[model samples]
Target: MPANFTIVTLGVADLDRSARFYRDLGWEQRGDQAEGITWFRTSGSWVGLYGYDALAEDAATEPVPADELPTYRGVTLALNLASEAAVDLAFARVQEVGGTIVKPAARTDWGGYSGYFADPDGHLWEIAHNPYWTVVDGRVDIGAT
Candidate 1:
């Protein structure tokens, strides 16, 4: 069997609020889905927001108590932009939508510009513009390993 990546589901403390955050970020939600789960179509895949407890139960895993979780979850989602200005604009928009700016957009050592922000759920998202990368149809290609 071949493995294929499809959806990235975020287990959010408040599904509606998380959905709203994404919506405010200009993401359009997909209709015709179940009311219990909200789905958004991305360039190549889908992003889903579901209730944390419901997601845990669906995955057959135990939900970690809030206090037991660390401030950094050690995972980050990235959005690669076309220009440095776009990166800055994106970071600002994130802040406008109530996301915490972890780092301001600036030139990077790798000859690119990037910044970080944390969504309402503290999921880190990196907005970057890599000179060596090629973006097409909203997907990024880092070029040959």
Candidate 2:
């Protein structure tokens, strides 16, 4: 099988709260799925939200206590934008929707603009715009000069 990722499941403490957070960010939820789970169809993939314990049980693993998780979980989701202005706008929107800003948007050493934020469940999301990259139909394409 091809190594294609189709879904991203976020184990949330409160499904309703997490769902609301995403909704407040202007994301529409897909309600046709089974109960006890929430889904959102993104440009290219799907994002899901489920109860932390339930998700752990579904995965046949123990859920780590929230406190036991490190400040930096070492994984981040990204939203690629077309320009620095768009990146700044997205960063502001994230803050407006209750996301905690980890880093305010600014010019990066790689000649791009980017910032980071954490959702209600502390999932890190980086909003960035790389001059050499293009996002088409939610897929990123790196164009070389």
lDDT of each: 0.86, 0.87
For model 2, residues 1-145, the per-residue Cα lDDT tens digits are: 9988899999888888889889888787998435899998888888999988999999999988976776579899999988888888888888898899999999999999988999888999999999988878767898765
The residue pairs found clashing in candidate 2 are none
Tell me the lDDT of candidate 2: 0.87
Top candidate, metric lDDT: 2
For every candidate in turn, the CA RMSD to the true structure comes to 1.7, 1.9
Q: Which whole-number lDDT from 0 to 100 does residue 120 have in model 2?
A: 85
Over the stretch 19-45, how does candidate 1's per-residue lDDT look in tens digits?
889999999898644578999888888
Where model 1 places Cα greater than 4 Å from the true spot, the runs are 1-3, 32-34
After aligning candidate 2 to the native by TM-score, how far in Å is the CA of 19 from where it should be? 0.5
- Pairs that collide, model 1: none
Tell me how far the alpha carbon of residue 57 in candidate 2 is from the true structure, in angstroms, after superposition. Answer: 1.2
